[model samples]
Target: MRRTSSISLTCLVLASATLGPALTAQSAAVTPDMVQTGSDIPAKWEEPHPGYDYEKREVMIPMRDGVKLHTVVIVPKGAKGLPILLERTPYNASGFSTDRPHMRDAVWSAQRDWADDGYIIVTQDIRGKYGSEGDYVMTRPPIGPLNPTKTDDTTDAWDTIDWLVKNIPESNGRVGMIGSSYDGWTVTMALLGPHPALKVAAPESPMIDGWMGDDWFHYGAFRQVNLDYFTEQSSQRAAGSQVPRPGSDDYQDFLDAVSAGHWAEANGFKQLPWWNRLSAHPAYDAFWQLQALDKLVVQKPASIPTVWLQGLWDQEDMYGAVHTWEALKAAGHASNNHLVMGPWYHSQVNRSAETLGPLKWKGDTAADFRRTILIPFFNTYLKDRKAAESLPAALIYNATENHWDKFADWPGVDEKHLTPMYLQSEFGLALNKPQAGEDSYLSDPAKPVPYLAPPVEADGGKRWQTWLVQDQRPVATRTDVLSYQTPVLDRAVSLEGAPFADLFVKTTGTDADFVVKIIDVYPPNDAEQPEMGGYQLPISLDIFRGRYRKSFPNPEAIPAGAVEEYRFRLPTVNYVFKPGHRIMVQIQSSLFPLYDRNPQTYVDNIFFAKPEDFRSATMTVEHNPQAASSVLLPIVSGK
Candidate 1:
């Protein structure tokens, strides 16, 4: 990877300014109100209110630890006995000004229905950020009852809710919490035995465990570009903080650093405290385990009604939402736990949900979601409304048919009917396993496979939001990548749960990385859309570091030239492989700057490996009756 100079930053800024309105228009055109059978109106369809007749106040709410967190509260003028909707976030809460509250924050725009319903809206800055009095702890771990007075996110949330319900005049004494991404994590933290006032929560795309499959690391493989960019953006805050130096081409910068054998020194990783702490704990040690929300959800089952909203195409924290939902269900909170999954990117539930990349849905998906699903859930629990009684335990949007489906319970492994798609020697996907054969590829670290190409820009660019659903045609031609496709499907195969890949592989080196992508191949002669006739849309993908095959906490080097079995889970997707569309699987060693390259030479800590540690390796994937390499699809029948 290489870094671009300040010039690239200027160009990126100018490009964003020029293209902002056009993109907004395109989204509006694609995502207009489409639901017909409901009296409930979509937020986008509703005419904008002239102004909020509310009394706005900014206050510093003190926690048990004596840290004052900055908070903004908006109450309807002369309104009393209203339910409270709270959102605590690391992102700046001041962005939502009371005078002009029409912002992109989902708590405001996406849930405008709540405002019309007369619930008090509140947003707060978490500790250690702008206007907050305490140091920010990234992904603050929950402090259980074992340690009293030891304040954490859980304690802070309890204190905040405790204070709000007691102190806020004209309060109904009932509260609901909701947030997406980092704020979502805060919502999950509060779910560890929520305060008495807290009745319901919706944590959308929360970060569960960074090391497993959330935002930072993917099964021990570090996500370099995203982590670096996020750290730089968040590290410096507070009034009058010095503006950081601008840099472009984060992909190139990281690649050059790793290539030059000076990863830490080149990128100045030490300066970023979170990165320093993360690098120190490479494996899933106590550092990451403490931050795992699944553990908390299991140990202390959520008593409050909770709705987990997740995007099937969420690039960052898909694992967090799904894993947390599963954990909660396993912990015997099935009746209180519900899930809503849609064809969306991270936080795109607030934006246009009708289309993602080249794929489009039937209706104004986002609008329908807000009007029918989101508002009713919160209203039922927070305000004791009966309208939400009809909501299902699981409301999943099937990308395959572009329709919503209801389930009595989540279709977990027990209910899933799996069909194995085996890899064949002729680069084909077969229902039956091959007798005996193997395919090999030389993975050169110097020329790794790009996750998306013509590479993404350094600064926060549009590709960051759209890349997960982007066409995979760019890397399909690379020799290092192995492609296998099934013949055109006679009928649609619907997948509703998690997908897993089982591979028997042999690497020439002591360690390596395996990347698997499940894709949907479109027909070439489609007259409706010629440009997307042969588009390869990735349904789900994941990376695994070979060293961690045996134990995530204790990784060991692979025995050179020895065959081994490697099984890993890709994020779940609710998609149907429609007729005429082929199901394809791609295997590759490295997905460039997106994930840090596995040096092929096993080192105690990959973060500190020298340039010489990086080496090219020959990798083989065996597909035979004995060592069959197959992708398991959780096919749903009768729908």
Candidate 2:
């Protein structure tokens, strides 16, 4: 049969090469319409080469609700008694293609260190997106009062794990779940009443609360930084189609839109249900509170050993891992729950993390994490249950010192350890509170302070990941931005946890937004690194919407020209303010284009506020003894 087929194939090739009468005659008559005429596909097709090392099988795994989700399972050749590692994603699961596929070449994160120490890898497209079946909902809330549906991420994940353990016949029934961002969120879902086979999980950079400090909004302010993502994620079932950019500069483009709601409507964003929901609930109502993972995980606690991987500079979903870790501990899931905070951006742990912006660590930080932290955790729980656990309660990287440290407890110290770094007169910052002083700036919505310097990229084109660490010198002199600095530190001042921004602020307008940035200013004469010399690297920063001063669920107008105390938690920081380096604070009303401009005039919703509502406002930061505006630092003891 082989010889007969070869002869026939050779004859066809010869005839085509010779331009025979049949071919020549038909070629002239053949039209574009007749290019592919017959249903001549093989009844069963096989891959020409299924790679040398691994075996891959694509399957539609059945969910409890009868929706078959597209899943790809890759098992290493000559494998037996190996546990399965699952990663559920809305992105296509075909990323694990076995034909000539490298196991380490994971989507989003190349050089997956965990892949080296093998497990049968499984990647699945969650229902309603990519190759999966069913309707898609944006960050679909878990099945509850909020998501009164038969199917949710929890059920889907549970079903997938159940199917994987039963069918994958690798012998060991234990399974480990791990992923980043949205994939990370799914990992957490699987933990809620997890399958008996599920042993361990690593949710890297998970999204906890959209309204609190996650992907959607921080505090009461919408992250205009994620404006592009907001539309791109939900407008389609697949991963294409983005909100068309009106101009090259998003800074100007966003400002020109007057309000994000009007701009969203202009770009046909009204078609997206989330957009409407966002418009409906601008406050932290039941809609947002119910889906918050920190709150949810606490209510639905589990005992599965889990690791929460957080990036100190994670550009997206920075709030999740830490918050969930804390919530779990408070709920008495402390023994199994672990936290790892590194000095990388987003999911940098999966890739090469030799350097972060200007600061290069001693070695490949990401590689070190996978080797020391991830693999061992997986081994201890999934592979060898009797193995001696070397993992710490909290493994954190000190970016300022370029070293990793393990703590018995995160923040290892209480809030009483907090030392107030007061904002003083003459644009100063000191441990001593000033007797009396008030510094003011006139902030205009039309000329809102730029988040980054001029020639800024649109939608974080290039600077998204390390924008937090960018030099703050460009806008230091801006009249609208109030810069206050502490003298060069005589000794190292190490911070262990979340820094609180306590401001005694008064605004000429009824409503305002305050952006507080805690920066590390380098000395002018750094001999080792000139580029980093005089660099103003921001360590912690966050914005607070003034209307949410008294209450988050309910917002009221801030009495114009009246003093108000607005205290908010900045992003957690584990760093050292080295000697000769100055600690500075920059206060501004708008971190424009990154966040929507507060109209300064209280409105029902800032998203729908009219152009006329955006007026110039004078913001005052008082450091008086009576109302001391200060930054509370969480000093790590015996550092």
Candidate 3:
């Protein structure tokens, strides 16, 4: 089942979702209703008005190194001195047109507010993507003082901004940038000593670093399927290449590829330059050090005002937004830095829906966010409008209460808010450390735990987007997973910050992986939501490759039968465990497909390991008074 060319890999990867009948049925049930054709705009948002007379034009903007980027500009006709709103994306900017009705798509419909505000909106294809002419560098590093001539995203952005302010008509010379995911990364790049014209930015769900917590890896563990899919989709030689579909049983194809020991060969890695580069660097070395956003904040703090938007349940880049915000604040930019998190997925900030997965909000969450929060933040810095009095340093939405809350700063700017919930024997969670005892489980790489059930197809589909909030009942009873839960609470326990797992464990093998999940267990007889009864909703979760426990750059084998501590942070979440709901902590070794399986045998690079290297291992979690395993929940005081 070796996929040869990059084009063939793209086809097979695109078709990866065509699993058997079981997956088809499961996907039908989980697919979001927001996938409907026609307008994504709500009926209330569609009010007739004297539409803005806008002119659209496409042009090639040259970078400092002579690379030309394809850009699209839409300006209101006869309007003068309008500020510029820019978005750079690898997803292609050709789709950005002012001719469409307000109800067209979420991206287009989202601009209605900006359109009504009479601002010039611009979208550009990043270098080496779409109509842009240049070589593509995945997660291009920011420029530094020593390498002033280096052609990176920062130089490209600076050149683009300089050209736009000078060449575009009716421009106020004030520029603001916004984007999500890869586009978000571009916005972050613009923060590297931004051009004088760039005033504001909002980077949503940006991939801060591949070595840390982002799309490529999570704490040293490779994100196998995600990396494969994204590389196949974005690293094409030509823009707008239609992704080809694989034959039926796409899930089987992925499984067969994994069993064969080389995902690179299985996905046609040899044909793509990015894949080749990715394969060459399996460890956190100089290759990934250059892409670290935290380092960039410390070295070059952007004095320009910026706002970060994050989805509490974002499957990818959740840590990037929260950590980047923290880094900026630590760099003494707290006054101008702001963060807003809501109950949404990766790019759902642009959506207009009120419900995500089985959970429903009180009102249209996305619409309200865009109308009240997003638009105003940009207006203040870009258009020189009065700042909204309602905006705060941190604005977070509570999932259980279905209302927004404000804070002076994220995590309350105090360390006392962090509370530890200790793990106890017999599947219990308590505030106090229990008697000396331990629990053990056999982890077989051959039968790695599935991250989500009803089984995910190869193509990922909607499941990939919504799986973060999927019900965890499928793996709750699995023997390989250890579950520790607290009794139903008498009062609501609201968690407002990042949660971290402190586990003291022993393993029979040299190396392993640790996966921790914080879940909310619904009551059984909640008649209003029978389908959600006893549902174990994961609030925040992450995997830590045990080899990186001491250092991310160095790999060391764990001594057999030796107790070691593995502490890692899960993505932050703001949620209330209402009365009668239980808080659960599930620990496991592997999250298949979502993360690559750890062979349990110490190897320099697991990516290139032989199939025979994978072995079963006996792992134990100690819960003694001294070696107490617990989860620290950042409980907001007086919540």
**Where in model 2 is the C-alpha error above 4 Å?**
1-38, 96-98, 101-111, 385-389
Best-fitting candidate, scored by TM-score: 2
Which lDDT values do the candidates have, in the order given?
0.81, 0.85, 0.81
After superposition of all CA atoms, the RMSD between model 1 and the true structure is 16.2
lDDT of 3 by residue, 545-617 (tens): 9998898888799989999999988888888899999999999998886778888999887877767778999
Candidate 1 residue-wise lDDT, 1-639, digit = tens: 335767798899999999999999987774345646666656545334455466667789999878899998878777798889899987788775535544222345655767777788888898887878887767766664323338877888899999899888878899999889988999998988689999989998988888899888899998876654445445566432222323455556667777312554454555766666777888988888877888878888868988888898888787888788887787777888888888899998877677888777888798788777787888887777766457787888888677888888776543336778999978989889787999999998878888767344653367877788888888888889999999999988888788898899999999999999999999986787787889898999999999999999999999989999998888887888889999999999988777888899999988878789889999999999989999988887775
Clash statistics: count for each candidate: 8, 0, 4
Q: How does residue 71 of candidate 2 score in lDDT?
A: 92
Q: After superposition, how far is residue 110 of candidate 1 from its true place, in Å?
A: 3.0
Q: Give me the runs in candidate 3 sitting further than 4 Å from their true place.
A: 1-52, 98-107, 144-149, 230-234, 239-251, 259-261, 412-417
* Candidate 1 worst ten-residue window by lDDT: 238-247
Over all chains combined, what TM-score does candidate 2 have?
0.92
Worst lDDT run of 10 residues, candidate 2, spans 105-114
Tell me the tens digit of each residue's lDDT in model 2 across 63-156.
8878999998877777899888888887777854434466555423532555577778888998888889999887889888878889999899
lDDT of 3 at 120: 87
